[model samples]
Target: MISTSKHITVFEHQAIKLNQEIDGVLFDETRLKALQSYYGENGVPYYSLIHNGVRFNEYVGVIQVGETIIEVLPKADNSLKGSNEKKRWRDILIDMLFAVGIFDIHSPSNSSLKLKSNSILDLYFELFIKEVEYLLHNGLVKQYRKKEGNVTALKGNILFGKHIQQNITHQERFYSRYSTYDVEHNLHSILFKTIKLLKQINTNVELHSRIGALLLHFPEMPEIKVSESTFEKLVFNRKTQSYKKAIDISKLLLLKYHPDVSKGRNNVLALMFDMNKLWEQFVFISIRRHKEKQITITAQTSKYFWKPESGYRSKIRPDIVVNKDKADCVVLDTKWKNLNGYNPSPDDLRQMYVYHEYYNAKRVALIYPGTNTSKSSGIYLDPITSKEIDKECSVISLSVEPKIREWQKNIYETFNNWLTFGNDNVQKNKNASL
Candidate 1:
């Protein structure tokens, strides 16, 4: 029974305005009068129809008149470009309209759309901005922190100690520490494990080739030409064809002839070793030749403490040692693990402490792999100097993202910083002596 009271033109489109009084009212006076006149004064009821095919179900017979009329807008026929074209533009437009606090196109019974202060796109942009800021502020290669535990020695065997009276002796033992450096070491260890696996299958020339291909993208290796019998004896048919065999043979050949792949890898390792040696040379040159400030780095250079005067010599090698003048030094040791994101054991810390005491170093740093939250640098207190020194030793964790250039930068910067710290210490000591 709704009837149009007025018409308006907007954007060259005609829209109808209905009388507000007729809202929700069936058989209004105007409609009833029209029906009666159309029926020619007959008492029988006459049905009336509205012109528009679209139904106004909610309002029924009533229509609220307004200055601005409701219009059926034409659909946009043009296609959206790029990403917009991949999705429905109409749906996106509708959502955008809802997001901006415009009229809701959903069910009327539903609650009003609540516009968020920040959209998903805004949040994504913020995250990207933060990542970019981190990359800019901190170099691609940076130091990370690791958590390590104190070391304690193992007690006597209680396997058959039923009475257990005399075995109650207390011995200094170390437990593992939780650190980030351990995590990185573990990651490297995985690479080492993969290398080990490839070594095991080295006898199977075909398998070796496949492994090499899988691990590296270098050119194919020239096939080793040997007598069929010798090849069978050395490689194909073996009682034990495990990875251990491959590693052993590879090591043997590396020590003997210096095979190309094995030799190249060894050379790279040797370079790392040589770099350790060259650090001293670089420092000396930088100071003496270039007239720059004196710098020194510390590493584990001695192998005496690990050896027992009475029993078999322990084959422990210290990772790194930093010496700044006579009094200040920092010792660092690296360990590789097979687990993901593991912390150092207490035994490791004890070993480090032993190095600290033997070398008279001020700090003992235990490095490990870094997780997301543990990317920052941190220091740990030495248990021995807790009362006297307040800060005895430091345990730090570093993050490595596995890029060649990044690795080089990390090594350079780390050594450089160590040198700088050592130089400062030397100056302070010189002033004190004066």
Candidate 2:
């Protein structure tokens, strides 16, 4: 549709040929030596053939083997040359050769050296060829090729079709959407697009760390709120539940206390829940702007202690708890799953219920990733009423589609909002007045 056949031919004929030649030269020492002699005596030579006699900033060295001369070009570092130029001289040379059909080239996997073979000039040309191939294959090199009106329209339609396919594929690979490519486009476009989006967002987000952790903790459950009283009691009593104990308690509570609590995939759910909890903690800590908030985020002040209560003598370690600027505390328990669903499973609802009951929290929230169908729906049951609460507990979702940079900004904003809001609320009701 988009002239796939033509694109393939160009890449295969040019890029593939250059790649084969480079690969041959890398493996062969004789041709490498001949190329080395072409560089001249200084071990570095300005090549008008590439960037109009521009001095190549980086040199990989040269070697001579029998009748052949080999010139090796190392990876270019622009900072050393103090130039903002995007294309290296070597890259320019290769693109010119590629345009002239001198030799084809291809980029090695993992950003390694470009490969070439055949004649000495071909080998030298291969360097530029591989770079050009990288640009073309990656969709970074865009050339305006004139086409018939009918063909242009057809091409547009083809591109639209490819975009749809790409979107569908992205939905399938949620964690890796930033690194996929359609048959018509290269993966580099996806990465570049993602990077561009990130640039628009706030800078507070730890782009790499948060996203990496998010991917690591996919298919996460919603956030659960634990009550402040329950939290204090558990903390004071020195008894708590770990992830393992929480699952056992959940199964027992649902099966015995509430028959409606359906036993779903406990093992897989538990793993996801734990991983999500760990990731949330990591993300929260990673992007926290206030140094004073560190203790609360890390939950390091309270020593771990175990006590016998409600069947399991477990160490109840709240995911996060901190006492800053006030005698009251902030408590949060991480839930790793969807928060709202029609006929929501009993186990998930109960888990949050338990947290709220145990901790006497003024506000509890169930955080989740918003979906198309269930953006507004989340479990907000009241601890006192045992009925679905209207909005006592919030159900918030972190966006999955935000650019890495934007995501960071959101995280920073969220943290700032929480801090400002908490401080304002605290000031409104002072203990000194009481």
The per-candidate count of clashes, in order, stands at 50, 50
Q: Estimate candidate 2's alpha-carbon lDDT, on a 0 to 1 scale.
A: 0.33
Local accuracy by lDDT, each model:
0.33, 0.33
Candidate 2 weakest ten by summed lDDT: 4-13
- TM-score for each prediction? 0.28, 0.28
Candidate 2 residue runs with Cα over 4 Å from true position: 1-278, 287-295, 299-312, 322-328, 338-345, 357-359, 371-391, 415-434
Candidate 1: deviation at residue 214, Å? 22
Off by over 4 Å in 1: 1-300, 306-316, 337-343, 372-391, 414-434
lDDT of 2 at 131: 40
Q: Which candidate tops lDDT?
A: 1
